[model samples]
Target: MSWTENIPTWQLVLLSIVGYVYLCRVLRYRRLQQKHALYPYKNREDFAKMTNQHAYEIQKYLFGVEFPFTMQKALEFALFRTYGIPSISSLLVKTKQLSEKQFASKRYADTVVLISEFMAWSPEAERTNAAIARMNYLHSLYQKKNLISNDDMLYTLSLFATEPCRWVNRYEWRQMTEMETCAMGTFWKSIGDAMNISYTPLTSSSLGWRDGLEFYEELHRWSLQYEEKAMLPSLDNKKTADETTALLLYDVPTSFVPTGRAIVSALMDDRLRKAMMYHPPPSYIQTGVETALTLRKLALRYLALPRPHFLRHDIISEKADENGRYHRIEYESEPWYMESNTRNRWGPQAWFKWMGGKPIPGTEGGLYRPQGYLIHEVGPKSQEKMGLREFEEGREVLMKAGRGSCPFSIGK
Candidate 1:
């Protein structure tokens, strides 16, 4: 028999009460500051009502992988750089009752809490603990074999303890950025143009790369005259850029690709390096700040980092594509294109830095470490080389591939 089915009604009630009380205590960041509070469920109905939403969402998450009611708990990979309690027993249980409207189920709710803790309260503690752990480890090694001077060992240990935070910050900052790429598409009168080019296309069109490029370029047209100076002080009287847009989908990717390529390349170029140092485009940094703030809004209570501060492009690296052809979105939780837009930067920005897409890493000797993204020199090859016409015809195609499941699997 199932555990819940076999349990007596009274026993279930008792367990729920105790579990909830423990959860309340856990919510309190510090015991000394305030006493723990109750779950605040006025009645069974209230508890069920709150929990039902999460259950529904969980079902959807599981259903996507064909594991709806019988879902596996998250593995203890400790893959992410956050301080979270291990063990997934609490995450596995599913209440059939809440499946209909589960929005804040225990699993998801707990995840939010953990996210908040990592971003907000846990960083300093984790840093300190890691340092202590390393020292202890090094000391144990020293005990095993006395090889070096105490001062040298001590200094090395100190560096090990403090080094991760910088790396963590770098990663966190980059993930907060969004990216996009545009293609042959059109918006309707409902969005903007009734006779737009985005509508006409069949898989059987456009044979080669040159033909495909020209074909989609027309579909994804941008009259550079207006957007190039929307805020030039002279254009203040002009309409908001979107008022003229038939659709919002194409705007983001088409614009981002070219400019992003140039901005990063100019920053990385040795010839332009001295001139642009510490004075990169205000738009780029502003976008980063905006991205961090947006994430802060959706962030769990634990992810409490201060507003991200931008380091004026002291160094920009141009080691990747100049056309800005990449398009990445981290909308696993988002419902639509707009929602995806909200979390756009977090993944692509990090990927961009990795694959020499933008902002060079460090300078050592005469060589720089290009960001870690795949290059198109070896774009994917398939039996049917896809063309612009096929993509327009609703046939899907991938232009590149790598060893892992997919290059896009950089982050969840």
Candidate 2:
């Protein structure tokens, strides 16, 4: 009453409205949580069937819609693994000259491409095949570069399978169902098989499939032992590891790097935190973050509101482009192919000559027909540019068949 008497009428009204709205939200959140607790799935098959039916929506929500948060969680999960950290740090050290420049956006772009391609939705057969092909390509490229060991590759694959589910289940508005977990496990197993990775873990459940939770805990325990023996051996390597962590957070302002490190420490398990010699964030900061996240969860779950779809459909799109329309180049296309070529420069001339001088495949009827000099000189800019027609036609076919166009389809 005394505080109200001191305040202006408008100010008092605004404060009352805010307080009422917050109270309503808290009540609704409690009701929703109580409702959700009533009927859990009866069995694994029931969960799997439900998840399979909504696979597209689920994938789109996790990877396409909530990508920024999902990506942060994924990164945190990777850093938590002791062996995983060294493997990633070593790869970054070998690939980019980060010290020369603070950070390069292209490195991040390349990673986004890989993640989008793997998670993009299509027909089951098509999606699986595309993912397998991409995985194979990446594995071959890494092997050729001698960037990672066999053990490192297997460990990385396991993390990929387990971490997203763990992160989402822990922090998202709703917990992931057993079926959803199984679906991810199935998808990742297919990828691991395609990569020919050995040492796959077996789930204890008679569900005849790998369980994400079991695999994650098993790997976590094994990683701790592995790091103690192998990762912590050399003082010089430890210094390099610290440098690599800084390089990873290069996008963060210098003044905020310590805060970033502390947040990462807070997210990790006690064993990993101790192993990395990381101090937790100040209690106040940690509590603030937790409270904010809890409020977000309550709002998301109780309001029955749609999840935010902030991520661009085309991962390469600029932030200013709200519609998400952007030029997308396929991995096997001209400029992109050249970028991946480690040896000599692969220009338009070489590509055209390899294509038997024709603009499109199956066009020449196997004859030694050569296009004119003008066409050759015009190169990729020519209307009959290499890969142009095939890509367009394939996209049209996908569209006509009720499937969406490829995310990486080249623009006109």
Candidate 3:
């Protein structure tokens, strides 16, 4: 009170605002810590039994603690895989909607929501089912839009099933164990089955949970080779390249374009750089970045303290009750949830209304639907349906390409 009396009115007002902000943040952190403390499992073994904990942990570490690094990897993957697909890239280019809407932001928000739901210990069944249903609906929309070929779809799916596991294993503070690997394989397999892909690359008999570790390693190895030589139809086009580059460097200063490009080149492999026709960074710059990253990794491994309370809980879901019950209001209020609601034209309310509380058509009886949604209103599907033979052929190609490939082919 005495100190406040000595301060000017303007200073006092600014101090009050700062105090309020700090207090709010502290309260929020405490609330999150309290909420996560109620999580059913105290250790890895208990979490492993849930069959989705590995995916949850991966998402938690990526989004909550290491968002920037995760986003960097994710963007690199998208540039090489999703955007590289001719049909998908064409659709994006034709839309001319980058400035009006940022797809990366929306995709990140949606992923947070999906992963949070899939990982919820309370109402586990309901949340799991909802995540699956939402994924199936999205797959249907993609098919209806006729934006990607079946081969592209399978390739993309393979990347998802393998990439995160590989990234986390290599760069994350903690390496995933055998059980965690199995959980990841199981989780993706379930999603693949729900989406009704004609033939998933991984089979129980040969490449199932038992071979989860090897399967992920092999898939990751093959994907790296495939991505290196895989030609992107739009890569050479100036307009498309500029637009894609802008999307990648959104919010960055124009003056720093060279520096930004240098960083991007440093992050990507030679094959990816060549595929995108980007010039490699200077040797000094690359060496500097590598040195800094090595220091960062060492610091994180040996010096960094435990994550703070604010970074403990997922940023997508709200604090649950003591009984672990979550309410619709709580879900809608989450930062990621609210962001999605604001960005998407057809938000959760519209989705719920469209479904009318009925089970999604393709996910019935837990039977995989090879051909999604028989709706006649959507124009005929453009993508060819992938069959067992086609899936096998694609696997063979990957295997051949991965011959003599090392596990740590791409390093951070």
TM-score of each: 0.16, 0.54, 0.55
Estimate the overall C-alpha local distance difference test score of candidate 3. 0.46
Q: Which stretches of candidate 2 lie over 4 Å from their true place?
A: 1-42, 46-57, 65-68, 75-88, 91-105, 123-135, 141-147, 200-253, 274-279, 308-412
Which candidate achieves the best TM-score against the true structure? 3
Error at 286, model 1, angstroms: 2.2
Query: Which candidate leads the pack in lDDT?
Result: 3
Root-mean-square deviation of Cα positions for candidate 1 versus the true structure, in angstroms: 29.2
lDDT of 2 at 188: 50
- Estimate the TM-score for candidate 3: 0.55
- Indicate whether candidate 2 or candidate 3 has the larger TM-score: 3
Q: What is residue 26's positional error in candidate 3, in angstroms?
A: 28
lDDT of 1 by residue, 238-297 (tens): 111111111112223555744543343322223222222222445665566557545743
Q: What is the TM-score (0 to 1) of candidate 2?
A: 0.54
State the lDDT of candidate 3 residue by residue for 201-300, as single tens digits: 3343243332334445555565566555554435433344445565466545668878877876786666556555678898887988778767766555
Q: With candidate 2 superimposed using the best TM-score fit, by how many Å does residue 133's alpha carbon deviate from the native?
A: 3.6
Candidate 1, which ten residues in sequence have the lowest lDDT sum? Answer: 178-187
Which ten residues in a row are the worst by lDDT in model 3? 403-412
Q: Residue by residue across 1-412, what tens digits does model 2's lDDT show?
A: 6867988999988887677667666664564454335434346434423222243344444555443365445743563353325554555555542212323223333343444544555434343233344435444546777776666766676666667767777677766655445545544543454455654333332333323334345554554455555453333334433554554564456689888776655666655555555566788768877787778666655443343344233432222123222222222211221112212124554455355432222233422111111111111122223443433443344334422211111110
lDDT of 2: 0.45
